[model samples]
Target: MGSQSARNIEVLNQNIAELNGDINVSFEFFPPTSEAMENTLWQSIDHLKKLKPKFVSVTYGANSGTRDRTHGVIKDIKERTGLIAAPHLTCIDASKDELKQIALDYWNSGIKHIVALRGDIPEGGDRPHMYAADLVELLKSQASFDVSVAAYPEVHPEAKTAQADLLALKAKMDAGADRAITQFFFDIESYLRFRDRCAAIGIDQEVVPGILPVSNYKTLVKFSKLCNVKVPNWMHKMYEGTDDDPTTRNLIGASIAMDMVKVLGEEGVKDFHFYTLNRSELSYAICHTLGIRP
Candidate 1:
């Protein structure tokens, strides 16, 4: 048994050596809604900043207050961390003129990267007048912004067909998007197939996989359903009966994430975007396993 365990360890070390610290990572954060949460967010940032991510992005919302908070967080990240901070811009509850103005403001403030998205329509609200592709064009016309748009490996919930979804992504890329950061996913095979389809359709832009380290299983499931992301039966069973033990859940989450990263890295994926959910331990551990260090 001891010899077998040593052999397994030797293989793992070989895989890490092959990865060769060539992986680049980025983190995503959401604006904190309360003082306590804000503190936690900053703590996580300080802890993970040592890893020196390529860029960090903050999610956006449709409301005015949330919009202000998003802007504040983006600027603060830039000022405090000296990291490239990207703010998410969505074409919902806003006009083209307004978005152009916002883009101009971001440019003037020295913010160069933007994550262009078509935000979720509010409950009972009117459908968006513009889409992500249009927003990408608008931003490009206003300034030379490094724009990143969203991609869905599992097919967007509203898309009528997988082909339509791929075309949507193509439109965004054609509109001068620098790259497409995918929605969080667990199914490694799904992402691999999606990449193949993109290449088949002549999409030359890079598509970075979004990795969500599950901190809370129940919360993940709820959000997954809303986003049309599937939680495989194995994952469901893995988390079953561990509701009260966060330590165990976190260990399991880290193991799954490390496994995913190992497989994806072997497939020549050099970039990973982590949806950190304002926590650092799980992501930090996973990065360490990938040979990323301070």
Candidate 2:
């Protein structure tokens, strides 16, 4: 038993040593609606910034008020941190001219990166759609912005077929997207297969894996269903009976995220994007374990 324990420690040390200083990370935040939430968001930012992420992005919402809030958050992030702050722009309910003007405004404000997406289709509101590819084209035409688009490893929920989804991603890249950040995924093999397919289809751009460290299992399940992401049964089993124990749940969450990062790093994936739900403790712990330090 003593020899086995010593061997486990040695193996763990080797893994940590291999991962140290070999990975790059980025974070995503959403616009906060209330003062308390705003404080929490900034606090999270302050904590994560120590790791020196490649960039930070604020997610865009569907309404005009949410759009304005996104811009505000972007501007504040830039002003406060002097970091590369990207705003997510979805071509869902706006005119081409309006999007063009918004792109121009962002460029003039010293913002250089944009996460372009085709946002969710509004309920019972069928409008002429401008796809993410269209938005990427519009942004590139308006300014020399570094555009990032979304990718799905398990396929998009609204996609007609997996092939069609791959073609859609290819179209976004063909439209001048610099890279693609995948939807948060749990199955490493699924993401690996998706990368192989992207390479096969001539998507030469880097598809950064998006990692959402599970904090609340219930919330993750609800969102996963909407996004058509399959949460593996083992994950459900791990979180079972931990609903009343946030401390235990957080520990499990960090361990799971750490395991995923270790595997991805071993697979030669250098860049990772973390979906930080405006809280930092779990992500901070995971990054620390990955040897990302202040």
Candidate 3:
């Protein structure tokens, strides 16, 4: 009887630890391409805004017009929801002067945070900024904005070696990036090991884990290939029979993300960044399960 009581107490402790609300979360969204997508984006934002994410970011695509559209959405998020809006700035085809102008424009428009990235190079385009470190430097030169840069637990697809990838991340941090948001990864140890390596290298800035809830396995697999993120075999096995069931897939996705949060929280990872893809339900459910309340 005493042993049974002790076991119940231990279980209660574990539950409390999981629901302690020590976690902070931010979300990411892409700029809408059409008016219908635009409306959907806002609706998702409205649903998730009450959760009080630390900040929200809008991504920039390769096109020139997409930049302004990203800005408008970010501005609206900031003005309407009063949440900190971060605009992703990619230095791909633009010259240094042009990139600097864009940074200044964001600053002038009362937007203060930027996610500096060496974005995807357009088809047959040259590398103008060369690296994300360059973009980080350029953004810092323009203003004292809170800058975030990308990190990879799995080495970047273009990186020649693991050491080279870590060095690139160090360079961005050295260039005054305030935080590093890692690319979404399924292997939990990938993040834990990356954090250890960053600590070993003395990159002391905040390293936030990026969590992505799988909405569609097929789409996720395609994106994982493009982003160099690996989907583990066990995960594939879990989603094997959910191809035709969106509801079951979402439940599975939320369960996967919640497990990650519980493990990561126990490991002392205090913050998370969600790649929302402008969809709310899965992300919202993950946060809700994490004890992140409205």
- Candidate RMSDs in Å, in order, are 2.0, 2.1, 2.9
Clashing pairs in 1: none
Q: Please write out the lDDT profile of model 1 over residues 1-294, one tens digit for every residue.
A: 699987866776677778866889999999999999999999988988899999999987777689889999999999998989999988886898889888998899889999999888988988789999999999999999999999999999999999999999999999999999999999999999999999999898889999999969999999999899989999999999999999999999999998898878877899999999999899999999888899
**Clashes (N, CA, C under 3 Å) per candidate:** 0, 0, 0
lDDT string, candidate 3, 1-294, tens digits: 699987865664486366556778999999998999888899999999999888999998877899889988988998999998999888876888888888888899889999988888777776564688988888888889999999999989989999999999999999899999999999999999999999999999989999999988999999899888989999999999898999999999998998887777767788999999899999998888678888
TM-score of model number 3:
0.93
TM-score versus the correct structure, for each prediction = 0.95, 0.95, 0.93
TM-score (C-alpha, index-matched) for candidate 2: 0.95
Mind giving the per-residue lDDT tens digits that candidate 2 earns over 1-294?
699987865666577668788888899999998999999999999999999989999997787789999999999999999889999998897889899888989999999999999898888878547899999999999888999999999999989999999999999999999999999999999999999999999999999999999989999999999998999999999999998999999989988898888778767788999999999998888888888899
